[model samples]
Target chain A: MKSLTKNDLTLLVAVAFLTLFAPFILNPFPEGSAMAQFNAGYPDLMQRFVIFGIFAIGFNILFGLTGYLSFGHAAFLGVGSYAAVWMFKLLSMNVIPAIILSVIVAGLFSLLIGFVSLRRSGIYFSILTLAFAQMMFALAYSVLTPITGGETGLQLALDDPRILGSSQTPEGNIPVPGLFGMEMRDSFDLELGSWVFTFNIGYYFCALVLIASFYLAIRIFRSPFGMMLRAVKSNQQRMNYTGLNTRPYTLAAFVISGMYAGLAGGLMASMDPLAGAERMQWTASGEVVLMTILGGAGTLIGPVLGAGFIKYFENIFSKINATILHEWFAFLPDGLEDFIVAILYPFIGKGWHLTLGILFMMVVIFLPGGLVEGGQRIRSWLQARKSKNGRPNGTTEPAE
Target chain B: MDAIILQILNGLDKGSAYALIALGLTLIFGTLGVVNFAHGALFMIGAFCAVTLSRILTLSHTVIDETKTDFLGNPLKVDVPYVHDIFGIAAGNAIIDWAVPLAILFAIPVMILVGVVMERGLIKHFYKRPHADQILVTFGLAIVLQEVIKYFYGANPIPTPAPAAFKGSFDFGAAIGFDPNLIIYPYWRIIYFLFATLIIGGVFAFLQFTTFGMVVRAGMADRETVGLLGINIDKRFTIMFGIAAAVAGLAGVMYTPINSPNYHMGMDFLVLSFVVVVVGGMGSLPGAVLAGFLLGVLESFASMREVIDIIPGINQIIIYLVAIIILLTRPRGLMGRKGVMED
Candidate 1:
C-alpha cells in the first residue's frame, strides 16, 4: 500500500471527527422539544446510515470505477444476510463469524454472477445482474425456503445447536448479537441540561467498519488497478485493442464490491438478526444505485451522504401524517389550512416514495454529478458572489 | 399429446402479452434509442383506463324510493347509474358489461397523449445522455407514475372482469377430437391471446406498409442520413413513441381481465418485458415478438406440475434463467442484429 497523501489524511481526519460526533450533530433538538420529531440521532437510523454507506461505497468501487452497474447487488447483500443468519444459527451470537461468513458467501456469489454477466456490458450487464438477483429472490422466496426461511426470512432459532456459544442467553431468551461480551443493542445515554444523547455500541461498530471501508475505497480509488478499471469505463474498445484483459480486473472489482455489500448485509443482520427475501429484490438493488447516484457516484463521500439523505427521508419524512400536516398549517384560515393539508398530504408519509422518485428525476436531469456536485455548485456560487462584493473567502475547493 | 398442446396453448397465451410489450419496447428503442423503464407504467395506465371507464359507466346517484322499504322499515334508497337514464337500462348494462373491451378505445388516445407528454416533458432531453441516465430517469418516472396510481386507486389489485359471455372455459380436447374433459382453457385468456396477436400484427403491418413507418425505419437505421435527406425525423420519432406507448397501453388494458389491474403490475411486467426485448435483440421488432412468445411458452412449460416436481421453483425463475443462458452464449439475443447495443 502507498502512503496516504495530505488530502487523504485530511479526509480521514474529517470522517473520523464527523462520525465520532455524529450523535451530537444528528440530534440538534433539545429533549421534550417540539422539533424532536426531526431528530435523526437514534441508533437504528444511525446504524443504517453507516451500513448503507458501506454498501454504497462498495457499489461505487464497481459502478463508479468500472461503470458496470450491477442491478443484482442486493442479491449479494441478501446472500450475505442469509450467510450471517446461518452463522448465527450454527456458531455463536458473535457478529465476527457472521460478518466474515457473509463477505465470503457474497464474494463467491458475485464471482459466479459477474463471470457470466461481465461477458456483456452496458444495459445487457444491468439486465443480466437484474435477472440473477431476481432468480436469487425467487429461490429465497420458495425453493430455498429451508435455508432462507422463505417469505418470513431466516431467523435465529431458539433450539439451534450453537457449538461456539449457547443458543439462548442465561435469561432463557434469544441471544442478542454481540462483540465477544458487549451487546450490540447496548447504549450509553448522556444527559446534559435539557438534552440527551445516546452513544450506541452497534452504531459505533458499524461506524468503525464504514470508516475502514471508506479508507480502503480511497486507496482503491488512487491505485493503479483503479486506474485500469476507469480505463475500461472510458473506452473498453481501446483497452481491448491495447491487449489488456479487462475481464479479470472487472471481475475482481465486482467481487470486492460484492464483499462490501455482504459486509453491510452482515452488519444489518447483526443489528436486526433477520434476513428476508425482500433483501434480494431488484428494488433494494435500485435503492443502492439511487443512493450512489444521489450522493454523487464516482465520488468517495457522495454515496455515504446519499445513503444518509435517503435513509433520513425514508424514516423521518415517512413518519409525518395528516395530523402533522394539519398542525403545521394550523395558523392559516380553516379553508386554507385544509387546502394546504390536502396539497401536502401526498408528498409525505406513504407518499415518501413519490417525493424520492421526483427528487431522483430532478437530480438526474439537472445535477448529473449528484448531491456532491450540488454542494460544489452552491459553494462556488457563494464564493463568486463573495468575490464580486470585494471580500474573498480563503476556503479552497473541497476534495473529490 | 393433448396435455402438450394445452401447455403450448398456455404458452401462446402468455407469449402474446410478452410479444406485445416487447414489440412496443423494440419500437421505442429502434425509433428513439431510449431504454424506457416507464413502458410498463404505460401498459398499467392503459389497464387503469378500463377501470376508469367502468367506474365512469357505473357512476351512480342515490334515489329515494317510496314503494320500497329497507330492512329497518325505512324508505329504500337505491343507487341508479346516470348511463341508465342516458342510454337506457339495457344499453347502459351492456356498456358496463363490456367496459374492458371499450377501454381499448379509451386507452388508445389517453396512452398516446401520455406518451407524447412523457417524451416532450422528460425523455426528449435525455436523447444525448448515456443509456444509464436514460434508465435512471425513466425508472424514476415509472416509480412516480406507479405511486400516483397507488395514491388514487390504493395499493390493492382491482378486478376488472371480462363480459359474461366469455366467462366459461373452452373444451379444447373436444375441439381437437380427444376426450371431452381432457383439456380446457379460459375464454378470456384466448381473447387476450387473439387481441395480442391483432395488436402485434397491426404494429408490424403499419411499420411495413406505411410511408411514415418506412421513414421511421430509415431514420432508425441511420438518423443522420435521414436528416441529411431534409426530412424532419424528430417529429415522426415522437409520434412513434406515442404509438409505442399506445401499444403497451392496449396490452395493459386487455390484460386487466386476465390478471386484474394493480399499480405495481406495470413494474412486475417491466423487468420481464425488458428481458424479452433484450432476448429478442434490442431493436428488432420481429425478434421482440418471437422472443416474447418463446419465453412465454417456456415459462408456462416450466410451471407445469411435472416440471415443478422435477425442479422446485422453476416456474418463478425460468424466464430469467433462460435469459442468462441466451445472453451469455448469444450476446445479441435470439435475433439481435450485429451492431444494435452490442457496445
Candidate 2:
C-alpha cells in the first residue's frame, strides 16, 4: 500500500471523487429542462458506467500491459453473471456469496481458456478466445437452456427454493438481491431546486468495488509483475531468450482480467437479478475491447473514462429522436433544417453504433493511444506553443 | 447411410461458402500480409448487391386495374415494373427470378471496385502496422460498413431466391442407388457446389498459369525479391486484394438462396471462416478450403440426431473444439507454411 506513487494516489483520488459524485456530476441539467434529455444520472446508466468501467479496467491489465487481446472475455462475464444468479436462486438473496462465487468461477473458467489460448500469440490467440466465447454463447443459448434459461434469460423465480432466505418478499414479489437487509434497487432521491439526484444503494456499492478494483489495477501497473507483462508485450522472444517463460505470466494476466470481468458481471446481476446469454456474445466482448482501446489501452484511468464515455453517449444518443432533432433545429429554415436533420439522423438515435464505429476507426487510425494520447498531444502542443513564444524555434522535435 | 449421405450433401453448399470466404481471407493475408477482418462485410455487401439488383429489376409504378375494386369500391391499382415495359412481362419476371444468378455478373464489377477502393484508400495505409492494428482498424471499418448496410436495408433478412429452373430438389439418393426420396438435395446447393468448384479452380488456375498471377505468387513468397526484379508487386497485390474481395462477394451473392441475406450474416460467417483459416493454416489457400469443407461436414455429422443424443451440444462447439485441438497440436494448422504469422 505504501508503494503507491504520488501520481497514482492523485489519479485514484480523482477517480474516487468522480465516481462518488457521479449522480450530481452526470445530471447537470435540471428536471424538465430542454437539455434534461441528455442527463445520464439515472440509476440504470450510472450502474452500467461503473460496472463496465470495472470490466474495461481488468481488460486493460491484460491487453494494455501484456499486449494480449482476448476476444472471449465476455464468456467469463457471462459465466460470472450466471453463477451469481444461480447463487441467488439456489442459496440466498445475499449478494456477497454470489459475487465471490462469480469471481472464483470466472477465474477458473478464464484459467482453462487462457491455458489453451496462451499457447499461441497474436491473432491466433484472439481467434481461439473468440471461438471459445462463441461456443459458450451457443451452448448457453440452446442445449444449456435449463441452466441458462435460453433466450428468455435466467431470472429469479417466485417458486425458487431459497435455502438461506425466504423465496419471496413480504409483498409477494420475488426477493430482490441485497447486501444484508439493504436491497440493491433501493434508492434515495435528493431534489435541489428543479434537479433530482438519485443516490442508489446498488450504485454506491458498485462504486466502492470499482474503486477497489481501480486501486488494485493501479498497484498492478506499478508492480514488477506489470513490468514483466510489459516486457512480454514488447518482445516475448527476447523474454524467452532471457530464460523467462512468458506463458505463465500471460495466462495469469488473462485469468486476472477474466476475474475482473466476472466481478463486473456479478455486480450487474446483483443490481438487476437477471442473467442473459446475450451478455456473453462476441459483440459484448468487442464492446469491452472498444471501451479499453477507446479510453487508451495502457493508461490507468483510460478504460474507466472510455467506459463512461461510451455508456453515457449510448444513453444520450439513443434519446435523440426526430422530434428532439426538430426541436433543436427549429431555428433553421424548413428545407435546410430537414436537410441537416436527414444528414444527421443516421449518426444519432438508433444509429449511434455507426457513430461509434466511425469514432473507433478514427481513434485507431489517428490516435492509437486513444483519448489519453489525444489529451497528451494537446498538452504537448500547448507547451510547445509556450516554448516557441519564449525561445524562438528552440524546440527540438516537431509537435505531432 | 442415407442420412449420412444427406448430411454430407447438405454440408457441401455451406462448406463451399466457407471455403470461398476462407480462400479470399488467405489471399489477402498471404499477398498483402494484412488481416482483413472487413472481408465478411464485403460478403454481406455482395448479398445486398443481389438484393439491390432484384429490387431494381422489380421497381414498379402503380397502374389502375378497373377490373378489381377495393372494399371501398375504388379501382384497384397494380404495380407495373419498368422491366416489364422494357423487356416484356415474362422476360422481366424471369430476370427478377434469376437476379441471384445474374448478380454474379453485377456483383463482380461492383465488388472489385469496392475491394480496390478499400485496399487503395484504407488498407494501403495499414501495410506497415502491426497485425493487431490491422485487425482493429478493419474491424471498425466492418462495423461502419455493416451499420451503413443496416441503414439502407432494414434489419430484416431479404430473401433472394435462385432462378425458377433451379428451384426444386434433386433426388440424389435415387440417382446414386440409395432409397428413393431419402437424399433430396436442393438444385441450387448442387449448383452452388459446382459454382464454388469453378471459382476455386479458376482462382488456382489464375495463380498457376498467368504471368500476373506468377508475379503475385512470387511476391507472396518474397516481396523484396519480386520488387528487386523490377516487377511491380504492390500493384499485383492490390489487384489480388480486389480478387479476394470479389471472391468473398461472389460467395455472399450465391449464398443468398441458401440463407436470407441479413446485415449480420457476414459477422456470423466471419468467426467460423476465421476458424477455418486458422485450422487450414493461416496463409495456406488450399488449407483454408480443406479445413472449411472438413469442418462443415464435421459440423453436420455432429448435428445428427444420434450424435446430439450422445453429446448434447456437440454441434455448436465442434468447429471451435476441432480448431482448439488442431491449433494446439499442429500449431501451424493442417498445411501451414513456416515463417508465416509465427511471431
Which stretches of model 2 miss by more than 4 angstroms? Answer: A390-400, B64-76
Candidate 1 chain B, which ten residues in sequence have the lowest lDDT sum?
B12-21
Candidate 2 docking class: high
lDDT of 1 by residue, A253-350 (tens): 99999999999999999999999999999999999999999999999889999999999999999999999888888899999999989998999999
Candidate 2 reaches a DockQ of: 0.83
Candidate number of the best DockQ: 1
Model 2 over residues B210-281: C-alpha lDDT tens digits? 998888889999999999998888888989999999999999999999899999999999989999999999
Q: lDDT of candidate 2?
A: 0.94
> What shift in Å separates residue B59 of candidate 1 from its native position after superposition?
0.6
- Reference-based lDDT, residue B99, model 1: 91
- Runs in model 1 lying further than 4 Å from the true structure: A391-400, B71-74
Which candidate number would show the highest lDDT if scored against the true structure? 2
